[model samples]
Target: MKKSIIIAAIINCMAISSFAQEFGKHFADSTLRLDYIFGGKVSSDGKPECQVLLDGLVRTTGWSGRRNNLVSMPLAGNGRVTVRDKESGDTIYVTTFSTLFQEWLAMPESREVARSFENSFLVPMPRRLVTIDVELYDSNRKKVVEMSHNVNPSDILIVDRSNVNPNPHRYIHRSTHPERAIDVAILSEGYSVAEMDSFYKAAEIAVDAILSHEPFRSRADEFNFVAVGAPSSDSGVSVPRLGAWKSTAAGSNFSTFYSDRYLTTRNVKRVHDCLINVPYEHIIILANTTEYGGGGIYNFYTLTTAGHASFRPVVVHEFGHSFGGLA
Candidate 1:
């Protein structure tokens, strides 16, 4: 029995060593950001067709995502991003996500006009050339459209934002290491520079709310929460229905798709730009408003009004959509 146990331990160690070596062989201790335009329109036959285009590649410091599961996804989300070695044609990494564009395609507006939405995703930086394929899937798991591109690590055009993000930030909770924990960044959306203290307090409340839940409560130490203070010039978010527009940090607004209280931000790239200096795997934007509304997209972001009477539960519910991938 002892001999068998010793042999099993040896095998596990060997597997760990192999995984590390394989990861180090292809990736660096950095991040590669892929920016894309996802668009679609109704065809003459009334069938909706969509396509994705490469916008740009960005390089940032640190890879705060998973070290294991480099070649697989736990959930087959609405879309997939696959990274493969250029020379070997071997898939080295894979991830799945859902986007606002996918949700917009179901709207009547898409049939009347062609529209595009900006999206951004992060992968571990590759040391060599790699081919990346971004694919969208239908409800039946059939491929809808795909865009493929090659990325070179030495490309001069890749924007380098390796410098520390200059925005003011505070850690509500922390983990010993980034890769071992789920990092969540709460960004101040409509709050002005003077209201950052309030934002921090709200972020702390959000952390407490999240930790009060079951699985998260048990695994609380495996989470890190940071509040990024990206102040707005205006003190509140826009309400198009009221003709009240504010120049907020994220360009977020209520009445998304003409639905009052449905708040969202189409400036996805800017949402990511705020976190270039912060380590985050998930995002939560706190709009400084007393309005009672919020929005969430799977693997994208959770945006909720911070001053609402139901702020605590609303934030928790939206997080279930963004982080928990709940319906």
Candidate 2:
């Protein structure tokens, strides 16, 4: 019995050592951003199929993901991204995330009309050439669509976003080490340049609300916060139900999906574009409006109205959807 227990312990240690070695061998200290279009269309035979197309690649500095779970996922999500060494064809990294595209798939509009959504996600940059496999799953956890693309680390076409943006920002809460921090970027949506100070104040309230929560409260030191002063042309967001429109930084708008209270934006590319040069694993958009509407998507983005009376609690609840990946 004693010999069996000792042998099991040795095997576990060997497995952990091998896992760490794989992460160091195949990945670098940088990050690779993979942009893709996730869409769906019905065929002549009445079968719906989801298609994936490579949009672009971005090279960014300082990967902020877990190094221990190199090839395993803690949860099974609607979508998965897997990176493998090209030569060995061995998976070096894997992660699961939910997408807004998956939510749109169930809408009635998708049945009759073909639609595509912009999706951009990141993985640890490979030291050498790698093959990226993207998989989409159904509600039953069955794989529905799969696509593989090869990536060369030395590709010149890859956009480099390591340089910081000229826009002014302030840290609400900062961890000593970024690589070990859950970095959240708070972006201004409808606040103009003159109202940036107000945006910063709202951002602080958001950081405090998140850190005051149960699990996050205990792990406050493991998180970092930054407020990006993305000025808008107007001072408030667009509310089509009231025939009010404003040119926001992230183009956020209310009346999403024809519901007056469902605030969301399909301009995902613009939202990400505004995040250039920001080191963030999560995003929160603060709209300069007093409306009682907001939206959140798992692993995508969270948005809340900063001028609302319940802004503090709403922001925290929306963040639970974005950061915690809660439904």
Candidate 3:
């Protein structure tokens, strides 16, 4: 079995290399983030269908993904985004991701009414104008929705977030090159300005727990870590069940989806805005609460309570969903 697994990995590497040869011919070295609203409703046939709407584009510096797998995706997730050359319509870059919106569709609430959720994704910037196609798939791996739009690299409307916010951040681990490493940013959610020291201490504990894990421990040198000290007005997140609400940095709250232990935040755009000045491919938010609750969304963000007794294990498990992309 080990030999078979090794052979399969080798074949995948060769295929990625073959596809990467076309990267330079079509795309540049920067990154472009496409934000969208993913909505769904029951059709006339009584089956659910999804739709995608454009939410603004932002250009950021340094793409931290693998250059070899520019056009081929190793995982066929619930959603995919593809970039193609405008003239020839040849696919130049492709990536797959899962979303919380898809999961909500399966819940009992979705069956009673229509709903929408905010979603975002990143792609390698093309050198010239290109067509971006976003696709959503159902549980049976069938394509249910698709939308396409054109993007010009020199367009003035694209927001540039390379130097915004410029908040103070510390690097726990620094890789030699970002382009070849996995970049992760840890953001402070509920710690006040005076409690930054505590936030830093919690960030250290989180980093240690992640690095002590299996694959990460063996490949420590291939990752970079940054702690963004985003201060808040208060020191604890909101517990809606207790009618206790505090002004946190990222607007996090408990009682998500009507579950008291399921902590989450709907302000995704604000979370990204806080890290505008930092370079990251993944994000983890540390909330300053001793409650045993947290949430994670694949390819989106991870939120975990830092002051709980089971903090280490729970945070690591949530990271598996947000960063490792495991279900």
Candidate 4:
């Protein structure tokens, strides 16, 4: 059994804000009075009670059916949010908000672990029995119902080498004229230009598939791509590995994987030798063949997805992360 990769396809709503809750406090830019009804892992019911406190947030008020994961209402309002049957759409036990209206705000300090942004809950290699669910209750109630919905980690999060954090002052040490003469180093431990050309051809095919969405048209300029030749063996030493393939969007900074990993975690002894060695922020790594898996990370590395698919997208996606204004 390989490590169970827990990826959170955490598509945080754009206008979200910091919220403080127990364990995982979620807050949106706007108050959400409505409870996400879960119906047997497929559908659920909603009773929009004009929960006054959540006026702008809650959509409507009404009664509901059976569901376990219910969002009790109005911190005392008589409304329930429940999950339904995956097939029948039958409600289980209705849920609502509890009377204890504990509102936790996100302070500037807790940005790193803020639950607002989707995170890859690293359940390292050799994954354990994984069973995930959601839950919430009314303000006046004291119980929570388990959501029927199941979320997959690989569907969202990526892992490269987000281990070493650069010094704050490093920003001051900028390259005299960054762009025209940026340090363009290729981290191909084993490929030649001709081989890389083939890899790029593979990458192009895959990347074109992802760009079909409308957003990619205007945001096209926000992307970059690179190719690596001989991949290194330091994967075990520098960062974590994936048991299976994974995927991520274009603007992610997962380019470091293609770079050589000499002393990744031991502090940027030689920033250049490590991932920080490059001038261009973004990077793309096209593994030569139909390998079994890949990984990605933020600021310090790269991610591997779509091994069975052509190499084009894998490289483009990595490049998207590396140069997508993440720095």
What C-alpha lDDT values do all the predictions have? 0.84, 0.80, 0.80, 0.27
The residue pairs found clashing in candidate 3 are none
Q: What TM-score, to 2 decimals, does candidate 2 have?
A: 0.88
lDDT of 2 by residue, 1-327 (tens): 343343233223212322355667888878888999999965555455799899999887776666665777545678899998899888888877788778777666767888888888878888899999999987788887999999998999998877756367789999765555667899999998899999999999989987787666765666789999988999999999889999888888898767777677777777777877677778899999999989887668899899999998999888876665555
- For model 3, residues 11-40, the per-residue Cα lDDT tens digits are 243223233556677778777889899888
Clashing pairs in 2: none
Query: In terms of TM-score, which candidate is strongest?
Result: 1
Instruction: Give me the displacement of residue 137 in model 3, in angstroms.
Output: 1.5
Worst-scoring 10-residue span by lDDT in model 3: 10-19
lDDT of 3: 0.80
Total clashing residue pairs per candidate? 0, 0, 0, 80
**What ordering of candidates by TM-score runs from best to worst?**
1, 3, 2, 4
* Per-residue lDDT of model 1, residues 176-206, tens digit only: 6445677789999988888999999999999
TM-score of each: 0.92, 0.88, 0.89, 0.27
Off by over 4 Å in 2: 1-22, 42-47, 164-166
Of the two candidates 1 and 3, the one with more favorable TM-score, higher being better, is 1
Best by lDDT, which number? 1
Ten contiguous residues with the weakest lDDT in model 1: 10-19
